[model samples]
Target: MDSLNIEPTEFTPRINFDPENNLFEISGFSRPENVIGFFRPILKWLDEYSDSVLSRNIDFNKSLLTVNLRMTYFNSASSKFILDILLEFMKYHSRGNEILINWYYEEGDDEIQESGEEISDMLGYPFDFIPY
Candidate 1:
């Protein structure tokens, strides 16, 4: 599958999903004018990626997919979509794919940390929280 790389704007974040490298990263501030419009393509890309991986029966045990989420700030509208993105990765994890989800929050930022924790709890998945 081809990689999905979206440059970050002032209101949106940078999205780099490289299947070949087994690394995915989303970072920056997310408060786009049209949240749905901004996130729809990302969600679709993830769905397609999942389908591709499953169809090929790729062995992910040796090379785990690493997903890094480094968000400085995201509005409430964006938070739901962010949660949805994580849930998609959770699907891969549930299917016996080794997925390492790293949630990066700025040091001394309790709000971001708590948000990640809440999402982790909601999905019943533990995330590696790293304070940057």
Candidate 2:
């Protein structure tokens, strides 16, 4: 499947989901006007991918997934949706998948740091923080 790339917008975060190497990245500020609509296709795609993996007997758990999150800021509404996206990957973790989240934050960015920590705490797999 072709990757999804959404440009930076006043309300939406830039998205770069690459399936070739299973590397997905979402960065920039996010406070989308229509949160669910903005994320529906992405969530749908992941759902289909999961189904495909199971039906084809494709061990996607063996595939490496590197997720990069370098958001400068996000509203609380966006935060909830982002967690939904992350949970998709978390599902694979239970199936023996190798996934890593390289979460970067600005120095002294307490909000971002705390946000990352909360997700990391909730994640099924371990995630590392990379402060810049």
Please write out the lDDT profile of model 2 over residues 1-132, one tens digit for every residue.
677788989878899988777888999999888988888888887787667752354654477778999999988888888899999888866666678889899999999998998888876456789999
Kindly give the stretch of ten consecutive residues in candidate 2 with the minimal lDDT sum: 52-61
Off-target runs (Cα >4 Å) in candidate 1 are: 58-63
What RMSD does each model have against the real structure?
1.5, 1.9
Which stretches of candidate 2 lie above 4 Å from their native place? Answer: 53-61
What's the alpha carbon RMSD for model 2? 1.9
* Local distance difference test values of all predictions, in order: 0.90, 0.83
Candidate 2 residue 71 Cα shift, in angstroms, is 0.8
| Model 2's TM-score against the true structure | 0.90
